[model samples]
Target: MKKLALLLAFPLVCYGLTIDEAVEKAVENNLQIKQQEMEIEKSRYQLEQDKNLFMPEFFMDFSYTTMKDTPYTKLPAGSLPFPLSFKQTNKDFRFFDFGINYYIFTGFARIEKIKISKLDIKANRLMLQEQVNTVSAKTKKAYLDVLMARAVVDVYRKQLEAVQKHLERVKEFYKQGLVARIEILQTKVKLSEIQRNLRKAEGELKIAKAVLQNVMNVNESLEVEPVKISLPDTLNIEELYTRALSNRSVIYSLKERVKQINSLEKIELSQFYPKVAAQLKYFYTDQYPYLDPKENYALVLGLQWKFQGAAPYYGYLKRKTENSKLRLRLQEIKNDIKLEVKAAYERFLTAKANLNVAESSLAEAEEYYRMVVEQFKNQLASTTDVLDAESMLTSARKGREISYYQLLKAYVDLEKAVGGSLKDEK
Candidate 1:
C-alpha cells in the first residue's frame, strides 16, 4: 500500500522539442535536399541552353600564308600562258572571313527542343519534391525513435525508483528484526538489477538521439531532445493513405518523366520533315587566281530535307514512340505503392490493437502489485510473493511503454508510405 502510494506520487516530466521545429531543422540541414537543390539549378541552366539554341551564331576567321616556291596555278581565260588553265605557284596572302548563321526553320524541331527542355526542367523540380517527401519521412521516423527511447528510459527510471524504495524498506524491517536479512539482501539485488536495466535503456536513448541528429543534419556528436510521446487520440489511417499517394514526391517525379517523354516523342517525329535556314557570308582574299573577294560576300540560303527512308530519323521516331514501356513501368510503380500503403496501414492498426492490450495488462498488474504489497505489510504474504508482484508491475509498465512506442512508429511508417507529413496533413 505504501509502495503503491509512492509510485502514484511519482511525477511524469514532459521534456524537449516540438514536431514542427524538428521538421524545420531537418529541412535546413539535410545534405540530400541540398544536392537536389543543386540539381534544380542545373536543370534551369539546361533550359537556358535550349533557349540559346534559337539565337544566331557569329564566327570570324583570319589567315596569313606564304608559299616558298613558285609553281603553275589555275587562272581565268587568257590570264596565264599555258593552254591548260592551271599553275603551281608561290605567293604570300592575307585573308579574313566573318559570318553569322541562324536557323530560320527546323521543321518545328527547335520549338520541340524548347518544349523538351522545359519538360526536363519540370521533371527536375518534381525530383526535388520527391526528395522532400523522402527526407521528411526519414526525419519524422528518427524523431519518433528518440521520443520512444526517452519514454523507455523514463519507464526504467520509474521501475528503478520503485525497486530502490523497496530495498530501503526491507533494510529497515531487517534492522528492526521484523524481516530476515536474506529478504533485505534479495531486495538490494533486485534494486541493483533495475539500476543496470535503467543504465542500458539510457545507453539506447543516447544512440537513438544520435540517429535523430543525423536525420536532422545536426553535428553527429550534438545532443537532441525530442517531444514527449503524447499519442494522438484521433488517428485516421485512411485519410493519411490518401494524402500520401497524392502528395508523394516520387509520384510527382514519375508524372514529370512521362511528360518529358511525350515531348521527346514529338521532337523525334519532327525529324522526318524538311528544315530551312537563312545564311549570309562576308570574305576578303588577295593574290588568288580567282574572282574578286567582293564576289564572295554574296548572300546565301539553305534547305535541308530528311528523306522518309532515312534510317536514323525513323529509328529515333521508333524508339521514342515505344516509350509506352515507360508508361507501363510507371503504372506498375503505382500499384506497388498501393500495396505498400496497405501494408503500412495494417501495421498501424495491429500495433494500435496490441497497445490496447498492453494498457489493460498494465492496469491489472498495478492492481495486483497494490494488493500484494498490502498483504505483505500485514504479514499475510511472503517476501517472494511481494517480489513477484513487483516484477509483474515493472514488466507490465515496460511492456506498455514499448508497445506505445511501437504503435507510434507504425503510425510514422504509414505516414511515410503515403508520402505526406502528418503535420502537413493536419
Candidate 2:
C-alpha cells in the first residue's frame, strides 16, 4: 500500500527531460569545454609546425654599397700589385641573391620529431574529451542539487503549515480551559521555531539556484524545473570497469604519452647519424666590377657528421632512461585508475541502497505524522506529540531528498570513473 501511495504521488512531482537535449545545451554553454577545445586547436597547430620541417626553405637577399680603403687584390700570377681604389663604406655596390636549402637527410631526426608531435596532438584531443566529461558531470550534479533544494523547501513549507494548524488547536483548547495556558504558549513557540527553520530552507534554495546558474552559464531570470530521471534496477559493475579502462580519456592520454616518448627517443638517437643537404643560389649584380663583387648562380651538395666528442651518444642514453621512467609512470597511472573504478562502483551500490532506505523511512514518517494529527484533534494526544511527529516527518523528507540527489551524483561519478555513460539500467 505504501508503494502504491508513492507511485500515485510520483506523477505530481515528476519532471521532464531528454538526455540528448540536456547534453547538447550544456556543451554549447560550458566554458571549460570551450577552453579545452582551444587547447586541442593549439596542439593541431603545433603538429603543422613540426610537419613543415621537412619542406625546402627559400629566401632572397639584395644589397648595395661602396667601400673605401680596402685591401689590395692579387694578380693572376699570385703577386700583389698596387692597392686598388676602394670605398671604406661602399658607395656603389649592389647585388641580389636567391637561395633554397633542402635537407636530404638528418639521421631521421626531423621525421621522428614530427611523429612525436603528432602523438602529442592525439593526446591533447583525448584531454579535451576528458575536460568535456568532467564539466558536464559537474553541471549535472549542480542541477540535481537545485532540484533537491527545491524539494526540501516544499517539505519545510508543508511542515510549517502542519505546525500552525496544531498550534491553533492548542490555543482553542486553552481558551476553553481544557488545556493549560502554558501548553498554548509552548505550541506558539514551536510554531515560531518551525517558521524560522522554513525561512532558512528557503534561503538555501536560493543559494542552490545561484550555483546552478553559474554552472549552466544561464541567466538568473531563466527558471529551471526538475526533470525526471529513471533509474535502472541493477548495474553490472564489472562491465563498467572494463569500459572505463578502455574509454577513459586519462588512460588514452597516457598511452599517447608513451608513444610520444618513444618517438622522442628515436629522434634523440638520430642525432648520432650524419645529415645531408642540397642548396642552390642565384645572384645578380648591377655595379661596375671594381665597385661591386661579382655574383653567379651556384648549386651545392653538403654532408655534416657531428660527433661532438661523443656528446650525442650520452644524450641518446639519457633520453632512453627518461622514456623508461615515463613508461613506469604510465603503469602507475593505470593501477590508480583500476582502484578508482572499484571504489566508484562500491559507492554507487551504497547510494542505491541508501535511496531505497530513505524512501521507506519517508513513507513511514508521513503516515506517523498523519496519525498523530488525528489523535491530537480527537483530544487523545498532546501538542508535544504532534510537534515531535512533525519534526520526524521533516527529517524523513529531507533524508529522502538528500539521498535521491546523492544517488544521482554517485551514478554520474561511476560513469566518469569508467570513461563513458552508464545509462540507467533497464
Candidate 3:
C-alpha cells in the first residue's frame, strides 16, 4: 500500500517536446523572426509619415535685430518736392510670426510617396511571414534529428546488452569444453565492438540534442516525443506547383517591391512639373516705420519650377530600369519555387519507399536473429553465426530508424516549399 501511495504521489513524469511546440518556440524566439517583425513596424511608421505629408505644416518664428545706423531712403534734391531722409526702421526691433504652409499641388508626387510607403509595409509583412516559415522548417528538422539519434542510441544499447548476455553464455560453454577458446575470443571481440558502437551512438545523441536546443533558442536538455510515421495519401505535382506560386511569401514580397518601384517612377516623373503652395501668415512687431503696420496678416501663393539639367528624366529612367529588373527577378523566383516544390516532392516519395523497404528488412532480420539464437542454444550454430545474425539485426534496426526520420524531415521540407501545412491543402 505504501508503494502504491508513493507511485500515486510521483505518478510518471513524461518530459517531452511535441513537433508543433518546438516550431512555436523557435518562431517565438528566433532572432531573425524578431528582426523581421521590427522591420515591419518601422515600415508602418514610414507609411504614417508619408500620409502626413498631405496635411498642412504649421511653424512659428521670433527674432530681434539691431542696426549700427537708422535705416533711411534719400532722393536727390530735384527728384522730389524736398530732400527725403527719415528713420525707415528702428535701430532695434523684435517681431513674432506664425504661419501654415500647405502644398496646393505637388504634381502627384506626394500621392505616389504614400503609395510607395504602403507597399513597403506590405512587403515587410510578407518578409516576416517568410522568415517564420523558414524558422519552422528548421525547428522541425532539428526535432526529427533528435528523435532519430535517440532511436539509434536505444538500438545500440539493446544490441550491447544482448551481446553481453551472449558473451557470458559463450564463456560458460568454453568452461564446459563445448566451445573452443577461439569462440570465446570471438564473442569478446563482438562485445567490444558493440560497446564502442554504443558509445558512439550516445555521443551522437548528445550532439543531436544540442542542435535541437540551438534551433529552439533554449539552454535546457530536450526530450522529444516519438513521432508517428504517416505518408501522404497522394501527391499531385501540378497542384503543388500551383499552390507554391500562389502561396509563397517571397513571391508576394517581390510583387510588392515591383509595385513600389512603379510608384517611385511616378514620383520621379512628377518632378518634371511645377509645385504650387499656399502660405497664411500672421505677424506682430514691437516697432514700425512710416509704411509698416504694427500687426498684419497675409496670404501668399507660390509656384516653384526647377529644371535640373535632365536630372528628372534620368531619375525616371532609373526607376523604370529598376522596375524591369524586379520583374525579371520575380520571374526567376517563381521558377525557383517551382523547382523547389518538385525536388521536395520527389524526396518525400523516395523517403517513403526507403522506409517501406527498411521495415521489411527489419522484420526479416528479427526473425533470422531469433532462429539463430535458438539454434545456438541447441549447439547447432557456431558462435560466429549468432554474432553475424545479431549484427544484421542491429543494422536493420538502425536503417529503419534513419528511414523513418528521413521521411518525416522530407515531409517538413515539402511543407516549407509549399509555404504552409499539407493538412491545410486537404
Name the top TM-score candidate: 3
Cα distance off (Å), candidate 3, residue 152: 0.4
Q: Local distance difference test, per candidate?
A: 0.75, 0.78, 0.90
TM-score of 1: 0.85
Give TM-scores for every candidate, taking all chains together and pairing residue i with residue i.
0.85, 0.85, 0.91
User: What value of lDDT does candidate 2 attain over all alpha carbons?
Assistant: 0.78
lDDT of 1 by residue, 103-199 (tens): 8877676777777777777777777777776777677777777777777788878877777777777777778888888887787777788888889
lDDT of 3 by residue, 113-173 (tens): 9888889889999999999999999999999999999999999988988988998999898
Candidate No. with top lDDT: 3
RMSD of 3: 3.2
Once fitted onto the true fold, the runs of candidate 3 whose alpha carbons sit more than 4 angstroms away are: 1-14, 71-84, 286-288, 424-426
lDDT of prediction 3: 0.90
Worst 10 residues of 3 by lDDT: 286-295
What RMSD, rounded to one decimal, does every model reach?
7.4, 7.4, 3.2
